[model samples]
Target chain A: MNVEQVRSAVLKLSVHNDAVLSEQGPHCPGSETLDIRHFGGEESIVRPAVTDMHFPEVVFPTSRVGRVAGLEKVRELVVEHHRLIWHSPLQPIFGGNEKHFWKAVELTADFHAEVCGGPKLYSERKGHPHLRERHFPFTIREKDRELWLDLYVQALRNVAFPLEVAEEYWRWVESLSIRMINRRTTFAEPVRVPFNHIAERLA
Target chain B: MNVEQVRSAVLKLSVHNDAVLSEQGPHCPGSETLDIRHFGGEESIVRPAVTDMHFPEVVFPTSRVGRVAGLEKVRELVVEHHRLIWHSPLQPIFGGNEKHFWKAVELTADFHAEVCGGPKLYSERKGHPHLRERHFPFTIREKDRELWLDLYVQALRNVAFPLEVAEEYWRWVESLSIRMINRRTTFAEPVRVPFNHIAERLA
Candidate 1:
């Protein structure tokens, strides 16, 4: 067969499932500066890189919730956490507009579902999560990260998550939260809410 | 100790390598539409999912070049191929400006090295290659894809890539070229150049 024919035939086989354009801003005249207007189109969301359960939260106990509640609980928990953020002072910082905030809630639900050992919803839908890049646009200060962690802790408590499940999930979010800190003032204040504030609710 | 204090201690363990933002365009008033100017900052590049070798090029002979020349050869091969594209009629379509052109060349080299079983430069620097999304801004018709493939074949001839290496690499390019095609008229026309035109140069 003519090599061109062969090459043409080969070209036909390249069927890709998804194609994601680079999130880095385009190189126009005023490209270097972080212009929110130009960056408005694509809200670069990425998957979390760190999945390991850490510390006290790492010592996870077997939970009946995951076996029974599964992804449904994940969605509910994420929605609850988002609702708290939505009403809190940090809402705008965390979620730019109402549409963006709701999108974040959906993405978080996908993340929780995937990371909690359920379906690979996030990766399959969104490709790998570049969490830092996704959060780069926001001025994620130390307090913001802590408040985020607090909301998750509160959400877990409110939902009555199994101790093992709650701690394990917290470990992931807590660590993941620190990386989100792109800005911070002097005096790196610690989290105001107790880490296991949800634990008391269980009792 | 207070649960919050102890939890704070646990929170200390949240370590992450990096977090990337979602690349999907922002949901601004007119964000949904694909505007090349808006997509201008970064020269969008992505990975091809269909990696299978195909057709007469299917029987890939083992290349002594990759074993002997290794990554150095990959760099040369990619650079040479990019140069051909740079000087050719296809230059503007592939690389809009000098800066973007060089960037494309660099990215292409990175991709070549990684797929040739060398260092994972592309993946490390650019995450997964969402080939389709990268090419989304350009109106890639069938002719464009074919011309791209032709350039590769010619480049291989110019560089005198080992028979096995040339064919093997061609299989990849031929397949990859198809994914870059975002537009085409009915009944895709055959390449203007003869198949194995590069092969004729071998004699």
Candidate 2:
């Protein structure tokens, strides 16, 4: 699927109706499901059709993340992600300022690098990373989150992120992105996009 | 009508089920409602039975809040609020360290004073007051928020906060408390306690 198709699918999947899920189960019956194959010959599994309301705690696969890609590549991915966001419809969400945009890219690079076990760059420069609080000034609805994930997918593809740890990295971002949503525009909870569904698209 | 009774009532009111409300309406039919009289001889209104999922932005009544009570009283209220939290079941959530507890009280006092239009003490000392982000480490569930509002109610009553701005102040804290909930322990949204319900009890 193309970026637009992927975006549409992600949005449809993430905002799965709670009423339907409750009557059915965690995996929505008859809803679209993607077969995700695990790396290293593990069993392939079907992506759950619905997401729980719980905002999960992301435990970064620091070792694998750092081993697969160095700091430079990580920085490149961060820059690419920002570039995608800047060029997308969500540009206004970042306040439409070039200086602020680049500054955000720099800070985000530092944060991503630190989270991936590169170095203590973010904390040393900016103190504790209270990310949710920092993003409070912006109004991030559920749709914005889907757009964000779409852009990130493009970034990962653009940078040719190693598939060895791509799923792990995808899981991190997928869960972490939910926490950034400060505003609620819908009764539906944010959707979850398993890496398998995007893996083929990225390839 | 004592603090304990008030706490129980607030807890019961705030956790009003969503299924029940949806079947009924915004104001839960047959649910207990409280009569709240306005300060300036306006009509007394009944408290709504349920709270929406939206986390409201607190607009401080700077003029009235500052006029009715000065910086000293605001500080006292902040300190008293923290004192109550420390003495209550929620004390452990503050890390059980006396030094950290007092430091939080000081910072909070600065924030409260500034928000009440006293001075920019908090922003001067600490860069910005990201209340939600700062509380990220704490597991602030819906019930925790209820307890917090309970204590704040007690603090307001104990300090004899001027009824002139009591409703305004209550609305601010009541809504602001929802923003601090980082964890979701239940499917139910946080309950809202209208000032009228507690006003009679406080009096």
Candidate 3:
């Protein structure tokens, strides 16, 4: 086969759901076997994978809010948080016109609300929330993530978010924010502030 | 002044060529004084700077080529290097349709040629090349950068780039590639491959 045809075939097989691609060859060492299944009930096709790099996953805090009032509370908290951050000193990080900024805020609110057990507004409108890809345009450093979290804490306190679910929510945002950091300024890992440390502020 | 007015004023001052802004107040600790000047000959406006973060700069290998056939040789090497990478296993890193890929390649070639002592093609067509911001859409890791350099070395040998100029070119790309890495897979700093180590390969 020509190089183009070979690449096309490999790409087709790699994307197939029932394709079981193994990279345990000379190309990549110590790579895991990927058992990708295609929706089509086609026979499994095995191929030597190119690169097995995986993008970071964003796990939303839906279950935590589901235990409480769920969607309504999530919407309230997310909207208030976005508002607080929009007004905060971190506003420059948005780096776009006012219209773009508000549009981003709306989309973000929809995504957060949907993820945290609200209606499927974000999914229905924007399909999948590729949060990392969406955030790639902005240069988010470790300090920026910290600043974001700080504003979020302030928003939670200002909105009087329920202290019962505050810890889980904080944990979710804290971890997820780390994934948004596209720029590294220091060799040290990002700082982690546990829920107990900010419990009194939320109360 | 209102927040928007203050922001606009700050942005104006920050972008000014002669405005000396200080972030040494309670806001940012140990921040250096920024002597930014405005081209409009307006009086310097000193203000409490917002964030003191600086984007990484891309220093091209213009001087090294000036010592040889200058722009012509740089263009030849850059074009061949790009062609090699486009055909390499790293093709997926471009992540677009064939038309988009070719456009990116052309734009990149223009930018590289302009930066490496060629004509003002990129700047005339596209404004400032915010390299990091432009590359934000791609999930470039340390491994990807290494793979890029590997393909680059092969390109250099294939094109038979001058030995004298090759070292500087390699150094330029090696350091510049690190800045392109937005995703951090390891806390350790990115690997550095000295030119001498790959001297045999280039020969």
Clashes of each: 42, 2, 14
- Candidate 2, residue A100: how far the Cα is off, in Å: 2.0
- Per-residue lDDT of candidate 1, residues B119-200 (tens digit): 5677667655545445644445456677777777777767767675565555456644554554322122224343355666
Ranking by DockQ: 1, 3, 2
Tell me the tens digit of each residue's lDDT in model 3 across B67-135: 464666666667777787777656666654778777767777776655555567776665544344345
Residue B113, candidate 2: Cα error in Å is: 40
- DockQ, each predicted model: 0.04, 0.02, 0.03
The per-residue C-alpha lDDT of model 3 at residue A137 equals: 40
- What lDDT score is found at residue B95 in candidate 2? 61
Task: Give per-residue CA lDDT, model 3, range A1-203, as digits (tens).
Answer: 53323433454444222112112112122112322221011222222212112222223354445446465666677777777777765666665367877777777777666555556677676553334434544456667788888888988888777888777567667766765676643323568877888888877
> Per candidate, chain B TM-score?
0.61, 0.72, 0.66
Which candidate do you rate higher for TM-score, 1 or 3?
Answer: 3
Model 1, position B161: C-alpha lDDT score: 72
Docking class of 2: incorrect
List clashing residue pairs in candidate 2. Answer: A14-A191, B14-B191
Candidate 1 Cα misplacement greater than 4 A, ranges: A1-203, B1-65, B189-198
Q: What digit string (tens of lDDT, one per residue) describes model 1 on residues A3-34?
A: 32243234333321122133332221111232
Evaluated with DockQ, which candidate comes out highest?
1
Query: What TM-score does each prediction get for chain A alone?
Result: 0.61, 0.73, 0.66
